[model samples]
Target: MTFVTKIRLQSGNRPALDRIVDEIRSTAERKGAELRGPHSAPPERLSVPQYKSTAGDEHRQFRSWDYTVYTREMEIVGHNELARQVTEFDFPDGVHVEAELKQVEQMA
Candidate 1:
């Protein structure tokens, strides 16, 4: 039996996200674990309009706030301990990580 760990990392701070991904990749390589990739996904763009009141033309001069969220994914195969450590690893502020583990049975 082998465990497959799927990791998803996202952050508004691109530099921080890239740094975390690099660290995970290096750690997996040092452990000689089967690593898949740090695949990048299209960034999510969000916009919000800032206004003091819902309906007020007297002072309705406002700007739209924009933010971009970057995302990356990686897969660890047959490395339960390593995966656990990664999931428990402390990440920097503005970076978010989500990990999922699945058990697979080998077929002869």
Candidate 2:
């Protein structure tokens, strides 16, 4: 059986996100882990309505707070140690990470 670790990272801070990804890539390279891509996804633009007061007032609303979210995804193939390191990495503020582990069984 083999394990695959898929990591998804998202942040509004592009520089911070890229930095983390680069660090992971370097670590994987040093450890001789099979890494598949820091694949980039299209930036998602999002907006949130800002309210002046807690009270529900249609007129008392500020301009929409808009931001773009960037996402990067990578996979570590059969390198459980490297995957664990990545998942346990202490990312900076505003960066979100999601890791999924899947088991692959060979068919004889």
Candidate 3:
């Protein structure tokens, strides 16, 4: 049996997101754990309209906020403890990480 840990990282700040991914990659390397990748996904763009008042000011019609969320995914193979360590790492502000573990059976 093997456990595959899938890690997903997201943040509106690209620099912060890259930094966290680098840290995780380096840590896994240092621990001699097999890491699949830091595969990047297309950035997700989001926009929200802003209104200062219920009546809606003249400027509010064109007022909106836009942000891009960058994402990266990686797999940690057969290392539950290492996966835990990576998941428990203290990441700086503006970065978010999620991890999922799944069991896989070996084929004969």
Candidate 4:
């Protein structure tokens, strides 16, 4: 039996996210976890602005901006133990985290 652990991390602190993702990947590989794509979601959408055309405006266009981000995913062979390990995974300061466990298989 196996389970896939989906880890959702929030935006902000790009460098920290990069380092953490790399570390997690390395650790998971060393531990023989069959992991899939981290599948990093797009940056956090923070602001959107709209302005009417002005006489001297260089350009007239609405704009939207977002903060960049990173995402990581890991596989778990032993559901319980892996869940515990995931909980203990190092998270950068001020970063938000959420996890969802999907059952991939069931062993008799």
RMSD of each: 2.3, 1.0, 2.0, 6.0
TM-score of each: 0.88, 0.95, 0.90, 0.63
Q: After superposition, how far is residue 82 of candidate 4 from its true place, in Å?
A: 4.1
What would the TM-score be for candidate 1 when compared with the true structure?
A: 0.88
Instruction: Name the lDDT value of residue 23 in candidate 3.
Output: 89
After superposing candidate 2, which stretches have Cα over 4 Å from the reference?
none
* Tens digits of per-residue lDDT for model 2, 1-106: 9999999999999999999999999999999999999999999999999989999587999999999999999999998989998998999999999999999997
- Rank list by lDDT: 2, 1, 3, 4
Alpha-carbon deviation at 95 in model 2, angstroms: 0.5
Model 4 clash pairs?
none
Tens-digit per-residue lDDT, 2-77, candidate 1? 8899999999999999999999999999999999989999999999778878775546847878999999999999
Q: By lDDT, is 1 or 3 better?
A: 1
Better of 3 and 4 by TM-score: 3
lDDT of 3 by residue, 36-101 (tens): 989999999999887877786857575588999999999999978999998989888888888899
lDDT of each: 0.91, 0.96, 0.90, 0.64
Index of the highest-lDDT prediction: 2
